[model samples]
Target: MPDHDEAVAAALDSYQYRLLPDHIHSHRADPTLAERLIDSFLQQLARYADRRDLDIHDTLAELHQQRIDRGGPDHAPEYSFRLGAQVQPRQQPAGDKAGNPLWRGFITALAATPDGQAQCTVRIPGVNQALHLTTAELEPADSLLPLPTRTAGIVIHAQEAEQTIIDIAARLKRAAGNGLATNEHALADLAQLTMRLSAWSGGQPDAIMRHLYDRIINAAHPPPQD
Candidate 1:
C-alpha cells in the first residue's frame, strides 16, 4: 500500500495550489500502489475544504492571481513547498447530556468497503485508546427505531442515537468520499441513505427523533457553515 500519511499531508499542504496534479504525479510514478492512497487523500481533502467552506475553484483562482501579482516565484523551490495556511480538520460536536446526534455531530469513518459495511473509528489527540464503531448495515430498523411523527414523550436515549448516528455518519462520510477517482460505492450509498432517511424522517411518528435523525442524515443541513 502507498503511504497514506504522506499523501494526506501533501494534499493538505497543497490545498490551495496543486493538490490534483501532485496527486496525479504521485500515482504516475507507480499507479498500482499509489492510486488508492491518492484517491482517499483527495476525498478527505475535499470534505475538509467543504467544512471550511473553501471553494477550490475560487481558491485556485486567487492563488493564480497572487502568482501573477507576485510575478511567479522568485525561484522555484528545489523541493515541494507548502504556502502557510491553516488546516482545520473536522471536529466532533459537543455531545448532549443524553449524548445524541446533535450533541456528537462530528464522526469519521475509516476505510469503507464496496459493500454497505463501514468501519467508524474516532481517534483523539491525547487518548491512548481509540473508539471504533463498526456498522455492517445501513438501515436503522435493527439499531434505531422508526422515527415517530410527534414528540409527546420522545425519549432520546444517548446510546441508541449515538450508535445509530455512528452508522449513518459512516455512510455519510463514505458518500462524501470523492476526489480524482470517485468512490462510487460511497456515493451510491450516500444517495441511497439520504433518500431513505429523508423518507424515514418525514413519515416517522416520533417528532423529536425525527428532526434529530433528519439533521444527522441530510448533507445540506445543520449546515456546515462556519
Candidate 2:
C-alpha cells in the first residue's frame, strides 16, 4: 500500500507512461486541437482533485499561454494527452526531468515480466527506432501509451479488500514452504492491493505491507547451493 502522497506519485508516474502524447509538436501546431487537449487535461485534473493533491490554479487558457511562452523542457510548446481519473501529473525524485533529454515515442508493446515488472517497447519518432523501457521509466509526457477505462473500474470494495489481505497471507504461507519467489499472480495482486489500500487507509498500510511482502519474497527464495 502507498500513502496518499506515494499513491499520488505512482498515479502521476502511470499517467506519464500511459497517457501523454507521443508527438506533442503536432498538437502544438494545430491551434484548435491543442486548445481542446489542454481543456481536457484541465478538466481531468479538476475531476481528480478530491482524490489527489494538485497545485494547479490556472485554467486552460492560462496554461496554453504559458506553454506558448515557456514550452516544455526542450523549449517548444507542446501539449500532452488527457489523463484518466486514476492517472497523475507529476513525478517524484524528478531528477531525470532536470537534465536528461526526453525522446518522443509511442509504446509499441507491453508485457508482464517474471520479476514483477512490466516490459514495454517504444517506437520513437524516426523510422526503425525503438526503445525498451519499463513502466517505471515511461511517463505520460515522455511516451504515448493508452490506458483503458477498464482499470478505473478497480474500486476498493471493503469486503473484497479484506479478502485480498487474507489471500495474500495464504500465499505467503505457501511461499514459505515452496521456497517461492517471482510468482506473477502474487506480484500483480500485490500491486493492485497497494492501489486499493491507498484508497482505504489513505496510505497508512502502504509501507507496512510493502516491506512485509519484500521480506517474505526474499526469505522464500534463497540462493541455491552453489
Candidate 3:
C-alpha cells in the first residue's frame, strides 16, 4: 500500500494529467501563473466541499461570503476584482501625464452597466470621492518600484515570507486538525493578519512594521490583570 504522502502525490498527478491542458501545464514555468492556478483550484475545491456539506472549518466559505458582501460581482466566465483590493489605473487620466506618479487605491465597489461592461469604484488616497472606471482600466498595485531595484527585491522577499507563513500554517492545520483551542486561536489570528495585509494601502511601511511588532509583543506578553 502506498504511504499517505505517496497517495497524495499520485492523486495530484492523476488530476493534473486528466484536467490540465498542455497550455496550462506550461504555466509551471512561471511562478506567478502557477500560484494563481493553485489558488483557483483550491477555491473550486472549497466550493465543491461546501456543496457536499463537507466544509467543517468553513474558513474558505466565510472568505467567499465576505467577497460577495464586499460587492464582488458574479459574472460567469469573466473575472472581477473584489472590493477592498488595491489597484492602479492602467493608463494615466486625460491631462495628467506630468510626473507619472504611482496612483494606487482600493476597490470600494463593483457594478455592471446596461451595456454589460464591468466597472469598479476605486478610492484613491488623495482623492476626495471614489472614481468609477472600467475593470480593464485597472491592474493590481503590487509593484512599488521597478524590477531589479533594491525596493523591488525587498518586496519579493516580503512576498516569499508571507507565502511561507501561509504555507506553514496550512500544513500545521492539516496535520494536527483545527479542533484544538490553540489551533482555533491561531487560525483566527492568521485570518485577521490576512485581512490587515490585504488592506494595506502601500503607505508608511515603517508604521506598518511597528504595528506588526507591537502585535507580536502584545501576543507574547499580554497585559496583567488588576
Candidate 4:
C-alpha cells in the first residue's frame, strides 16, 4: 500500500480487530488481504482527517487530480487501485460533464412573534437549531412587511420561488439545538447573504419561501427590491 494510505489502514485495522480479532489473521493467509487492507487504510485515513478538521472532500479531490496528472497507462482505478497491472486513467463521471448541478434551493423559513417587541425567527430544514437573528437596524419603515423590532433572516435561495414548509420546534430550547443571533454573511457581494438593510431587507425567510412558487411560473420574475 502507498504511504498516504497508512493512516486509513491503521484505523480500519483497529475497527476490524474490535469486531473480529481473528479476521485479520484469517486474511493473513488470503491472497486478497493486501488489497482489502489498502481499502481499509483509505477509509481510516478519511476518518482521521475528519477528526482533525481536515477537508476530506478536498483531499479526495486532490487525489483524483493527482491521478489525472499522472494520467497515462500507469495507474489503476480507485476501487481497483492495486487489483492488477497498470491501467488507463479512469474517465470523469457523466454528471461532471453535465452543466453544474441545479441544486433545489436549500429549504428555509422565517416566522415572527406577534408581541410588540417581536423578533424575526428563521428555521432551516435539516438543521436541528433555529437561527435566532437580530435585525435592529435593517427593518425598513416603508416595507410591506415591516422588519420586526429586532429579528433577522438569511436569504438562501430566496429567489428560487419555492416555499419550504417546515415545522420548527418551539422556542422551548428542547427541540431546538443552537442559535445564530448574528448574521453569518454580513457583507454584500454578488452571491452572499448579508445583514445590511439594503442587502438583506428582502431576505426574510418567510418572504423568500413565499417567492419559491413564483419561480415555477418564471425564474426571471423579480421580487420587490430594496
Q: Model 1: per-residue lDDT, tens digit, 97-186?
A: 443231111123454556643444432111211344333211111112233222112213223333343354545554556424445554
lDDT of 4 by residue, 1-226 (tens): 7453566557656766765687637443554875676577678779998899988886476456435434432342332121111112123435334342211111133334565332334332112123443222111111111122211243233221112111111121222235534232221121122222223223444343343334423433335689
Task: Please give, for residues 119-219, the per-residue lDDT of candidate 3 as tens digits.
Answer: 88876533322688887666656522211221113222223333333443554445455454445545544454334343444334333333345444444
Candidate 4 TM-score, true structure as reference: 0.23
In angstroms, what RMSD does candidate 4 have relative to the true structure? 21.3
Task: Compute the lDDT of residue 99 as modeled in candidate 2.
Answer: 49
Candidate 4: stretches off by over 4 Å: 1-19, 24-31, 73-226
RMSD of each: 20.7, 17.6, 14.0, 21.3
Backbone steric clashes in candidate 2, count: 6
Candidate 1 similarity to native, TM-score: 0.17
- In Å, residue 13's CA in model 1 sits off its true spot by 60
Task: Please provide the root mean square deviation of candidate 2 (C-alpha atoms, Å).
Answer: 17.6
What is the C-alpha local distance difference test score of each model? Answer: 0.37, 0.45, 0.51, 0.34
List model 2 lDDT by residue over 135-204, tens digit each: 5444444211121122233433333343455455556667667786746655566566555544432343
Span of ten consecutive residues with least summed lDDT in model 2: 81-90
